[model samples]
Target: MKGRWLVVPTVAAYATRTLRVPLAGWSLTGEAQGVGPVTRRVYWIDIASPRRPETEVVTHLLQHLPEMIPPVLAAFRRVRRGGGPTGVGDRFTVLMLGVRRGRVQVVEVDPTHFRLQTLRQHSESGWIEFRSEPLVGNSYRLTVVSQVRASSWYDRATYLLGVGILQRMTWESGLRRALKVSGGRKAGHGTTTVEWP
Candidate 1:
């Protein structure tokens, strides 16, 4: 198991180097690259809670995301109605490590699920969804799924080397903190699973 674990970082380093080849001016169309147009990954945590409505849990999570996440890296807020299309088309922006990264549009919203898609030039492109599901007990499962494609080879390399890991760590920490602050105990360590397609 230790040797297997060690292979992860080694493979990551090799993949980063392999993807470092410049792809300047190259564009990626949504196509199957064995990873589809977007790579999909899921992260989830189970939080102990009273019998709360799924919508309440999701709403609370969304509203608290900005605060839960690392302040220096990202911030989120709902754009004013007059500023753009409201409701389902609501807009938001995310800063990557404190720099304006891209715009996001709320594409879908429901009591148990919310989805947002990137709208501007960004290192990665695609959508992310957050969902809440009732578990066997009074607790709930909060899951976040991200499907994105690297805009360039450099972006891909950066993701492989450190950015991806940082994002995962930040996300898991934020969720754990959010649960704790909301009077919920995390059932266990959050789990992140990556899928090529």
Candidate 2:
């Protein structure tokens, strides 16, 4: 039940975690509020399901996102801003690395997909989306997509340094967790793609 109340423990844990994320050739495609180019990263996993496992997993994540995040690496602390079941218009105050805090809002949502937009003062200016879609018989593709630019030159520098790699790892870990929690096996080898255009 780590949301707003359990932040201190996680922040304390951050001191021991090291940052050694591998680098990638991230594509900067779109304009970011005139600050810079947009970086797009996408991760997906194919789930072979006999029932509505995909929907159940999505609902679970929408209710408790911390389950998807890899605690050892990212250690991100997320707190809901409003009081009620998670849904559209929900806001989350994200504490990253126990050093920076940013705001993200649920801008759009549905049974199969949902989008979160980063608000002002956040490290990046863009949105990240989680979507589940039917690919064929008894299989679905769960995807996490993000397109954002650093909120400022300082943030961009840190991103290029290592934050970007950490972000990629976070989503990949989330996808794997979602797949495993869905009570399904991988329909095929998972894929991680970075798009620039």
Off by over 4 Å in 1: 1-37, 81-86
Please provide, for model 2 over 155-197, each residue's C-alpha lDDT reduced to its tens digit, 9 standing for 90 to 100: 7776777777787778888888887778788776454545353
- The TM-score of candidate 1 is 0.71
TM-score of each: 0.71, 0.74
Residue 133 displacement (Å), model 1: 0.5
**Candidate 1 residue lDDT tens string, 66-177:** 6666767666666544443234666665666653355567778878888877653455677778887888877777778878887666567777877888778767766676
Model 2 residue-pair collision total:
0
Best by lDDT: 2
Every model's Cα RMSD, please? 8.2, 9.9
Give per-residue lDDT, candidate 1, residue 140: 79
